[model samples]
Target: MKALRVLLLLSLVAGSGAAAEPAADTGREPFVFQSDRIDFDRERNLVAATGDVELAREGRILRADRIVLDRNTGIARADGNVTLIEPDGEVLFADSVELTDDLRDGFVEQFKARLGTGSRLAASSGQLQGGTRAELNQAVYSACEPCADDPSKAPVWQVKARRVTHDRVEQQVTYRDAVLEMWGVPVLYSPYLSHPDPDVTRKSGFLTPTVGHRSDLGVRIETPWFWNIGPDQDATFIPIVASQRGFIGAGEYRQLFDRGRLELSGSLATLDKKPKERARSGPRGHLRLKGESHAGDDWRLRGEFYRASDDGYLDLVGLDSSETLPSFAEAEGFFDRAYARVGVFDVQELRSGVSGDTSPLAGPELLYEWQDAPSPDGAGRRPAAGAALHRRREDENQRVTLEGGWRLERFTDGGHRLEVGAGLRGDFAHGDGAADDNNTRLLPQASAGWSYLLAGGMEDLQMTIEPRAQVVLGRNSADADEFPMEDNRAVEFEFDNLFALNRFPGLDGAETGQRIDYGVQTSLHGAGDWHVDAGIGQSQRRKANRDAPEDSGLDTAVSDIVGRVGLTAGEMTALGYRFRLDKDDLTARQTALDLSVNLDPLYFDARYARAVGVPDPQKPPGPAQDKEEREQVDVGLGSKLDANWSVLSRYRRDLDTGRSLLGGLGLKYEDECLLFEAAFEREYKVAGGDPDNRVSVRLVFRDLGSLPGTQGVLPGGRR
Candidate 1:
């Protein structure tokens, strides 16, 4: 035998004249062959190659131990260790195969293939058509990796079909009489099934269904359909059928553009009507629209609108749990040293006994702020102006404000720091209804502060301590009572806002009179990634402001002491605490604690909070008219039992009332090809009504639209 490697150009022509033309002119690639030994038979127009034969044409390659090609029939046959590589990176293996001259169409025995998505397919026999379609008999498909220790062992999950077809052009796989198996045991059978090819990211199809039981809604199943409307647009429709509640439908539509995106989501349902109802049935629904766009390089426009048919509709449908729905639109701009915004907003109250008409609608609010470049010595100044118009059924008001400020800081070589600042603000307001008056006021404010740092320790351990204090002085507004309070009704004095020049959150109110805020903070760093930090502070005023609310913690000449403490050890444990103590008795007025620990496969987290309301000094000292204390705690823990299994549990309780507010437990298993989840949740009080219990189960098969909770009622009966 002689080793022969030949490049043969074989073309099929319709006539003798066409055969005279070159293969390039026909727009088709000719076959090229290589072999250790080659033979040709002129009478039959056949070529036989043996021992490591290889053929290549148009980006497709075929290799075998022996191959025979017939020029008269444009067919090739190969036996023993046959392998074919397609243009799209798919590899097929068979014991024996027959294919067209171009290798675009083929038939294989004992076929096995490796797809682009790392999945595997095997069949007793396979037929390839037009290079884009494959039909198989007695096929098995799986995305799970086979056992490494024992090659013959079954995968975690697989699908077996009597017949299966894959169409590359349509990017889909269709199966007939398919049986889904787990660990080689058949669990489900379907007459017909289809899914998008692994290469497809999005397509039109019915997504996985959600099955659950709720006390109020009973047993429910939700099946959703997704539509790939276009390259940049899509929509999903979720229709739910409940054993006791009939039907409910929800949908979401989204579109994308070069600079922005828009989304719309809504749901509607009809239920039994009470006496004197205007319509045939009581209808409930909700709509939400959100959009954002870049108007230019420095400006953005954004808007969101939310509306519900009734106060309890969103809660009952597990859509939203907020007590108030708000709608707003705004345009914002950013510049080198300035910022501006224009916006409007409206709110609808959902709390029982609260009239929606009392909620104010604010529109045409304008704001502009600019800051000057800092001076060489670390000094800067900012000037701002704003205007707002507010209206409600009971009252109407308009306010305009102008403000300017400046500050400077200096540091000494000895670790001593100094800061100083001054500013002026003016407010003009016109009110009607509740406050029928016009008011104008000017406030001048100034502040100064100083601090020192001391640090020293070994390389493995370090410690630092810092003491700071600030004094602020401002002229009090004389006629503040003549104007209505719009945005400054609630005030909280905490460590975060202790040293601010103005403690009030809004311009409608201001902290006045001379005051001094002082505090000291310390930290320690040790080996093994250990660290600790603590800080404490207090505020002292020359005279108490009579207009301050009783529970503000700042109504007295000496305000509450606020502090925080934190500790951490590597990545395994962390603890943080914050508290406010009454000045007179040193009693805790408010406190919060948070702890988290991660220990190998197990993790835990907890949060606790408590607040004591201050008694109104002017309330004649009788029984309190409202609850004055609040306490709550939340705990969560989870464990990853193994690489593919996990459990999670959570509980929330009202410590003051010793009542469990909510509790939940969940178990999940996930692997390369499948995900399974089950959860149970209990709510002690829902919408101020009776308790509710729910259970949910979900299954997700890899490479399918089986998201866990994107469309249905999530854990705890919330979406």
Candidate 2:
């Protein structure tokens, strides 16, 4: 009943801008009076201006055909062509107006107002509760046309309301039955709405929701609610609605301290319940921590932690789209040219994993890194102090790493350059246990480099070629036996990024022992925006101590060959190839070739790989294992021909078995108002000729004038 009464009163007030007011004081003589006459009424203690009359008090001016002032009420009533001018450069006109001496707050009928700043407003009935605001019966707000000398006639966008209550203290207006209008044409309407007048502090309201679908998760719906919690913190709750059945929710919390900021998010419920039954679910969560702060003039502190509840949990629920999440913490800063850091890492428990299984491992890793930037002087550069400490539960032995490196670079005239570098390293690790334990030692370290470059060409032709060489001398005590190994994850965050012409994620692992790597690389660019480059190298490892010990698995060798080549035409076509050759057998141990092309809106990529004597990853491992030579070929096709549609397709085949291993497709639709997408993929097997995994995806979004269910969506139109 109260709400209804409020609504009823608002409706009346919106449509009616007229209100009665008492007459003003008549003791002071009016500065100006016009028309037929000025009448003084002693009995009523009122002064009246009749005919085409005008009255002035201080800087306020009033124009009306007739005016009456009451000494007791200090109110002024004007009829016919009533206008009020306040001290603050505001001119107000109305058919009938009742005002106080100050005119800061009052009532008016058929009100039309133009303020000091040229912003205009109008209402049929209203009450000016304060100097800069009013409770209007109906009002319009806009600044499309400047209210110049004649501000009343300016063009404007309006907000029509049945009733509007404007609060100067909060600088906002609340309304019922509001419609958005432009040039007097209604475009949108809403039952209730609120907006800040111009500038204000924190305000709470609804936010837009996102819609999408995943093959495994089915249809997806997420609506987020925002909370403006105090001044230093805020939060948002996003609820996910699944078509299949179940609610998965997520939220983010943020807070700021004097030294740092913190943010975290985790899912509370999920739709999939395969590996973990719903009974045991929702207890799992993830954590992340990162911060940076100044400690001294030249030293700083930084750290990052990323980890998930379980390894497969994120993959199953799609919480981790990147497939791999590492939980690690490190703190390191620099002083002058040198730097160092130490990090501790732990693995995220994998779902459906056996209690104690090894293999399929990267081993264990602990890293201590150091680096130094070069100075402008011609003095020799400094070397880095680095180390790695690692051990695996699967293998008996732990590992230790110590290394240092230095390099020099100089640019020559005519776009030429040169560089030289060297390094030393040592590694100690054991495998197996006690008597059966195998100890592997490497007193191996050496490096050298002499490289050159040239870049000068015709208007359309440019080229460069460089040759490099390095030497390493080291010894190895290799009685390391391979035990069932499990934990091995090496994580890196560095400024000295490695640049190579191969797709191998860990190419640096093979960079040890005594060896001299020599290679010449050449690059050419001519007409048609085409480019080509290739590199060939051979490594000569140290074996000077061969006569001192019996034969072990570790054999110091001579030159082993490695090379890579690549080419790209116009901006549309590309090709790449790389190979590793064993010096003892003169056979290529591993080879890969890839090709890609873009036909305007269409693009495609094909790749082939062969490991001459290796077994397939899907096959069993044991003595006398049936090792099907590892060979594979894959292709991907994607295109966006028109503005509204796009598609992507991928396929992979095992050449040796003549089998299709994988295939997938993705499609999308986009336009001015709506967006839609769909995707499907399958993981196939050879003998069964059936896919082991299948996936599908979809998403859609619409633009509404304002966020849904928000008070800002006046006129109820899409924003």
Candidate 3:
């Protein structure tokens, strides 16, 4: 019956506030001196009540066998199984308790308090001064609000501190003789510990370490120190140390500005590589710098820097060969509006140790535009529209270009279309040697063109025809003087849509030339998502001086035709073919063929090309006007696959050398926290360049902290 009564009494006082009122002295009955079952007395003006006494005021509740309230002073004391409850559902129990208003300052010989947020705090005996401070000795805190008697079974761990003082303003807790325990077992102890509060707004701390292995570098490790400086800025210092090719040291710095942010990284290694002669390479280093900024009115600046020792350093160290390093400086600036842009570009090479310095690539270009339409959203419909003036120089001679042109591109719901305007551009140059500025005749140049598109036979099947014409009025055109004139002819045909209908990589200039080009194209679909597209075109030109290569049947001809057909099967299958003809001789001048296949877990791409020069052409016996020639071919294949892991490979063939030009392969594997990759490739050339191989690895971790009770290493206590 006593236990039941005790349990009932606790239920009534749980989560209740402490209540104790002072007695009045204005002829009052000492608040209370006697009751039917209790007695009260005033000794030395100290109001004392005894026997099943219970006091309740405001929302606070106080219960005990005896209570003392000193009316003359501002203090209250409760003895024998005393319990004090606050309005916020925090209950405090102790053998004896004393408190002032606001609970700002309190004392309990033995105390335990349970807060509402699944947390509990306790100490043998202590004092709390409002939210700003708390001085505790031998305290234990935990996220778990354990059941009354099974604290060991709580789901969370607790941090124990011998002496701790917390500062609410700074949201930090400093402690001595601290121990972090889980299920009653102390996993860690600290003579002194300081950590961000549970509600700390600014988290500052140390970071975790990174480790990895590379066949070339052996082992690498790094630990970074992070500083939370303040709200607007922060920084970290990371020291990277690695073994394999001697000791390598590295560091990185980053900063954020009001208008932009910048990041810079650099590394150095002594005796880093195996040398061909008596000693290994001296000290080597790599640096990368980047930044981006924006101003008002569409004005922006951005750039990056990448440099290193001879390219071989990357290959030997298993780094990316594709990482092109420019020991030179290349800078560009842009100022623009929606319809116009002005820009300047400069390149200065720093490789020479000569007595003088010069910039080889320096130029300023200006272009203006007037438009009355919104820009197209697709790349195929993004046509150029402007007139540009540029100056060029080679060795000592210089020339200028004055060209004006217009192009219109639009994509309707059903198809795409383009209309291009031609321009008359004249190049005037002078040099010590007439051999430098090819054209001496000051040619009269003019050009114009139009193209159309029409769809038919289902949405997937479309046909397009682009017809173009250009007329030039003059040319000395002498084979002995290959120059004294520019040779702008046809282009080497490739998959690039840039000037697609115009074949031959522009080898000879078209002057005093009249040519009509006809292009007919079509696309079809079916089979493993197969896609087919084909096109054929023809052109013709005339020269003022017949001494031109046309006499060799390789220059100006009555007609030349080119055609290509290609098909794509699903994500991995492809096949293509190309052919060119010399109309005057009715013969073949070029031919090409290719095939490829790709699948998710697998991939492949291949290509082949050939150019046939006119060694001899018998203009079709009588008047038929058609010729035939030999072919020079170039071919390559690249592929990737996945089984136990992923792999990549590439192969190339150069018929001109009757040898393979290049080939390569690579493999990789990765998971949530760790990643690794390695590759070996070779690019063969009759002269210059070799196979470049590379390897790389990376790892990520979480909840990394200085100690169990400290702030996490990450920007946040995420893990």
Candidate 4:
């Protein structure tokens, strides 16, 4: 055997005398051939290579045990373990192959291909043409990896077809007489089927259809069509048919721009039978639109619009579960040391007895804040201002506010920290309609605080305790009673705002009179990644605030005590609790608890909340009065039975009434090539009427889209 390497150049024009020219001079890549043994017959224009033969041209490479080529005909034949590699990372293997010298057009026996997208295809024979198309007979396609322990074992899922065609230019695959198999067992058969190749990012097509059963809606099926309008925009239209109800139409459209994007989605339906409470049948629908854009280098604008045909329409169609719909538009600016914003908003009430007209419309609200750079001594000044207008059916109100503040901090060598601050604010307000009034007032406020940290611990255990105190003195607005509380309708006293110069959340309200807030926060860390943190605080005012409501928890001289506790053990377990206790009786007014645990195959989580309402001081207790006491609990549990199977369950109940609100159970199975899920849910309470039950199922094929019941078939669709 002779190891010979030859570079062959063949010109398209016969007898052009370019065979001896260099590959670059001829303007075409020459075929570089290698073999341990080679023979050539110049008269017949034939070349033969044997024993580890290899040929390379352009980016394509072919190798085999033996090869024969005809220069005049530009043909090549390879036998014994033939392999061809394409430029785009595709590898083809066959027992024997015959192709043009360029390798674009070929015929292979016992063909197998590994695609760039991690998919596999195999056929008894295949024909490659035009460098972009392949036709196969008796083919099988799958995305699953072969079993490592048992190489001959069947995949989890695969598609077998009598004839298969792949079009690289179009990025699509079409199959005839296709049969879907699971574990080598035929489960479904189709005369014709087609899908986009894995390389296709977007294409117009009909997505998977969803099927489900609901107690209120009966049996329903939804089929959606997606339109790939352009590179920057797309849309999906959904049409649903129900056995017991009317036909429903829904759609979503989205577009992207250089500086912004917009989206709109909605649904509409006309019932076949009108409800007994309505006089006539009418169409019900819901609409939502959202958009955002960059206005400048440091500014952005955003807006949202939402509407519904009726209160019960959303609930009946399972569109949304919100109790209110809100619409708003706003612009925000960000600077090095300043911030500004302007916005307008409105809300629509969806509750049964609530009137939308009662919801206030607020617009043309402006807020601005700026702060100076801190000096070497940690001292700075901040100025803030705001204005707003609110309108309702009964009245309209306008307000303007301005404030200035300064602060400084110092840390002592003895582990003591001190802080001081002061500010002055002015407020102007006017009201019309039911309450016609005008008022102006100037408010001055000041605050000081101190804290110290104490630490002690061993190598395995450490502890730290910090005790903090602050005193705030502020003068109330002289005409506080002349204006209504628009943004400060609900006031909560908690540890989060215990030490602030002004505890009120809105400009319409302010904390008045001198008060002292004190709290102690402590933490402990032990071996095995265990830790605990706790804090407790209370406020004491010099005198009761007449402007504060009785149930606000801050109207009395001694405010309610607020505190929280948290514990964690590594990444497996966590617990947190927050509570507000009445000052006089030390009874809990509000409490919230959360706990979660994760132990390998098992996981659990639970949440509980309770709040006690206070009676109106001006009204006597009676059976007709509304009770505000509320308590609820939610719990979830899950377990992984094995590598491919899992079960989950959830329950939510009203503790006060001992009634279940919602409960659900789910099961899932997933592997390398397939996923299947089924769920059952029972809703014990709904806005419109009686209890409801729903069952849904979903299946997904790897590298392919989902078979939908609740989940969407496209990328980023509903899940």
Which has the greatest TM-score?
1
The runs of at least 3 residues in candidate 4 whose Cα sits more than 4 Å from the true structure, single-residue gaps closed, are: 1-5, 11-26, 34-44, 50-53, 274-280, 376-394, 434-436, 476-480, 614-627, 686-688, 706-719
Give the least accurate 10-residue stretch of model 1, judged by summed lDDT. 614-623
- In model 2, state the lDDT of residue 653: 83
Per-candidate TM equals 0.91, 0.57, 0.49, 0.90
lDDT of candidates 1 onward, in order: 0.81, 0.55, 0.48, 0.79
Tens digits of lDDT, candidate 2, 631-710: 78988888896976877788888887787877766676655333445555565533363343433333322211123333
lDDT of 4 by residue, 462-578 (tens): 999999999888874335577657676556666777776766678788778878999999999999999999999999988887777565678888889999999999999999999
Model 2 segments beyond 4 Å from truth?
1-218, 228-234, 243-245, 255-260, 270-311, 321-324, 349-400, 404-444, 451-459, 476-514, 540-561, 568-600, 603-641, 644-719
- The alpha-carbon RMSD values of the candidates against the true structure, listed in the order shown, are 3.9, 12.0, 13.6, 4.1
lDDT string for model 1 (351-372, tens) is: 6656777667877677788887
Q: Give the Cα-based TM-score of candidate 4 against the true structure.
A: 0.90
Candidate 3 lDDT, 1-719, residue by residue in tens: 12111111221211222222222222222122221133223344454556655565445666667766553443557788776665544566677877642234667777666544334667888776763566777887765546457754743357789887766567666778988775568878889877655444445655555554444455555565666676655555556555766655555556777776777766666745534423246776667786766654455555567666544454344333342344222222343322333333333222222111222222233333333344453211111211122223434333333333334445456444444433333444444455554443333333334445655564554444443333323333323343323223222432222133223222123334444444667677653477788876655555332433342223555545667888887766778887766666756566677766655545555566555543222121211222333333333333333333565556666664476655545455432222234444344433434432222232222122222232221110111
Q: What is the Å distance of residue 34 in model 4 from its true position?
A: 4.7
By lDDT, the better pick of 3 and 4 is: 4
